[model samples]
Each structure stands twice: as structure tokens, then as C-alpha cells.
Target: MTLLSIAGGIVDDSALSSMASNASTRKTFIDSSITIGGPYNFHGLDLDWEFSSTTTDMSNLVFRSLSYPAEAMENNLDWITVMAFDIGAPTWKPNLTEAPAALYNPFSEVSGDSEISSWIRAGFPARKIVFGLPYYGYAWKLKDANNHGFLAPANGADITADGALGYTHIRNRIIGQGGAITAFNYTFASDYCYNGTTWVGYDDVKSILAKILYAKGKGLLGYFTWRVGLDDNWTLSKTV
Candidate 1:
């Protein structure tokens, strides 16, 4: 089956009509295994932890959208993708053993996934909610003597096409240069590499697979990613 999670921005009238036309024109495309999905960004929400907050809202919104008439939500779309991440450093201290605390403390003491699962169960069709498994992790600078800390972007550091390094461009450089990657067991699934000076953290196949299993156990539809191309090695897809 070929599940197609339509990005959320395609919900407009013109876009919907365009999609319907495309669906009719493509004879080679099998309708089976096809599902439409929505987009939710962790960085775009109001919750203490963007990841958990966005998932909660996304699950609810998708359920409502799916229940709407075909004119609003294409009938061919059968699922929605909720973006989830594996980093807790920005919102809480990186605790290898204990779950990180939420910044907003909604449902005090709730773990990230627990909050997300609860929201998903509240309204979304459990079988039609696809969780997003990230292929990267955030790198945070350990607190220094100056008491300052730094965070790595969840999307990996941004990189120039020419491969110049910026605050956000270093991680990609290391990965592209064939640096040795290392995995560390923490409350959040995290992996890191060293450039002989700075430490970089991100996600990999094992971490992504763990998220897929978590979604499956929650009776979710399946998994999705922001984009499939970043994982050039296909390790993430193989795990799925």
C-alpha cells in the first residue's frame, strides 16, 4: 500500500480540487494503502514542550478535519501525521534516567509521550493517526562555568550548499564528512558525534524505530517523516 500523507497546507479549496484532479488523472496510482496526512510543527505551538503540545493539537485537529465532509477533507485521505521529537533538553534538563519535566507543567508530571497519547485518544481515530519519527536529535551544550547553555536545532544545523559551517551548520558537516556517530541511552533517544572539539547530537535508525513501535502500540496508523530524502542511507526506512 502507498500511503500518501498530504501536507496540511494542501487543504485549501484550490488545492483540494487540484488534488482530486490529480487523483483522477493518475491511473498507475493505487488508491489502496493511500492516506492523506496533515502537518504539525513542534516549533509552532504554545505548549511547554513544542513536541508534545503540537502532537496533542494535531491529533485533535486531524480527527475533526477527517470527520468533516469530503469537500473539506478529501475522502481518499485516511490518516494524519503528528510530528514528534526525541529531545527534552530545550524544555527540561537532559536526564538520562528520569523523564524531563514539562515547561508549562500541564497535567503536572506527565511525560511527553503520555501527554501525546492521551490527547490522541481523546478524539482522533487511533487507527488513523500516524506518528512522525524524527531522524535527528538536538545537541545542547552542557552548562559551562559561565552558566550558559546552547541548543542544537532539531533539524540538524543548517548547512550551506558549499558546506560552510554556521552555528547550525556544524552537525551536517560532521555527518557529511563521515564522522563516527555514537548513541547514548538517555530519557530521550539521542545520538552524538565528536568533531575533535564540539559534541553534536541527533537521531538515527534505532531511535526512529522505537518511535514507530510506540505509535503502533498506541494503535496509531503508522509513521511519517518531515521529508524522506535526508535519510539518504535508507536506514530509517529499512527500520520502518
Candidate 2:
């Protein structure tokens, strides 16, 4: 059965109405959320709670309550896919330490912390933990053309989609057509593709494989991606 996962855990003013204030409302949401799938044989929900650090209400109330529904939903479905990307960034900007860097740095301090562990600590089962891989890179418009590497300063992301460029675009258009320099950081297990003044950070085949192996080692359920369409003809998908 094809299950369409819905995005959750976002507090756009409120998640299914003030879950913190109205305790009854929280249960109502939990009850009603399941009914959404009754008409259609959809698989499950993918809880993507992004940028919870941006606000206090997000961090406190949303943080305290967000996971309950996901744990509940997991029981109701065949599977659930949780987002596990955006764990690191090279944007220490303007500082000398910041330079051009990969979006998905497996060996970075943050990645080392392992959000997956946090979920398990929060009480989610590891077998249900479908880790995520990024099929895109974060781009930065350089503040100084020559100043580029891991943690380089930048004006900001150069492209739309939060300065993101997809893997397929990086492959066919940037590297293939523009002759970008593809370099790997062995220590960190990440990749950098620089086409002239523009620098992007993404996962290459090697980095993807490395992550998959790591996940397998941890006995993870499987892996998922933030995007599949953006991959080079689903090259990353096939490889994973």
C-alpha cells in the first residue's frame, strides 16, 4: 500500500489548535488526526518539526507536546518517515572559521550528537527510526570570492529554496556543464562542489553510502530523503 505521509510538528501559531492551553483540544487533535486517513488508505504521517529553536513557544509548548502524536500515529500506520536533515551548516559566517562547507556533514559535532539518539531518548523506537539523507546542497553567495571553504562567510544562500540547489542540478548543470570542482572531506564524510565563485554543500555518492552504512550499523529501520525528484535521475535513491 502506498502511504502518503503528512507533515506535522510545526507550530504555525498552533498545531491543530493550542495543544498546550486546551488539554482537551490536544486529545481532540490526536483523535481527529487518525480520522483523516479513514477515507483514504494513506500510509502515515511524516513529522517534520523544523526550526523549533526559532521561538520560545515552539521550544517550550511545541517541544513538550509534539512527539506524543507521532508516537501515537506510528501505532496506527504501517510506517512513518521522520525528517533528520538540517543538522549542520557551514554558516558561521564572517568569522574566519566559517567557510564553504557541506550541508550534510556526518562527522560534524552536531551530527556526532545524533538526533536519532534524542528521538530514542524521547521514547521513539529505533526500528521505526527511518533516517533522512539530503539530496540537495546549501549554496552561499560569497562575501569574498577567494574566501571559501568550510565555515566561510557569505551574504546568504544564493539560490531559492533557502539557498538550496538540488543534487541533480549540481550534477548536470553545475558540475557537468560548468565544470565545478568536486572535493570530498574524508575526515568529515561530506562533499563540496565549487563552480567558480559559487559554492554548494551536498552529499555525493560516497557520503550517501557512508551514511547508509552507518545507519545499517546502528540497526536503523531504513533511510529516506528530503527530496527524490531533485536527485540526478534519482541517482542517490538508486544508490541508497
List pairs with backbone clashes in candidate 2.
Answer: 3-43, 98-151, 98-152, 99-149, 99-150, 99-151, 99-152, 100-149
Q: What's model 1's TM-score?
A: 0.47
lDDT of 2 at 60: 42
Per-residue lDDT tens digits for candidate 2, residues 42-159, read: 6554444443443444434344343444565456544445555554443433232221223234435455225666666666777877777888777766667777676666666665
Whole-model lDDT values for every prediction: 0.42, 0.62
Candidate 1, which ten residues in sequence have the lowest lDDT sum?
95-104
For model 1, the stretches where C-alpha displacement exceeds 4 angstroms are 1-77, 86-112, 137-181
lDDT of 1 by residue, 82-182 (tens): 55543253324342211122111233344436545654545556776666655444444332322211232232221232111221233345666664345
- Per model, how many backbone clashes are there? 6, 8
TM-score of candidate 2 relative to the true fold: 0.72
The TM-score values for the models, in the order shown, are 0.47, 0.72
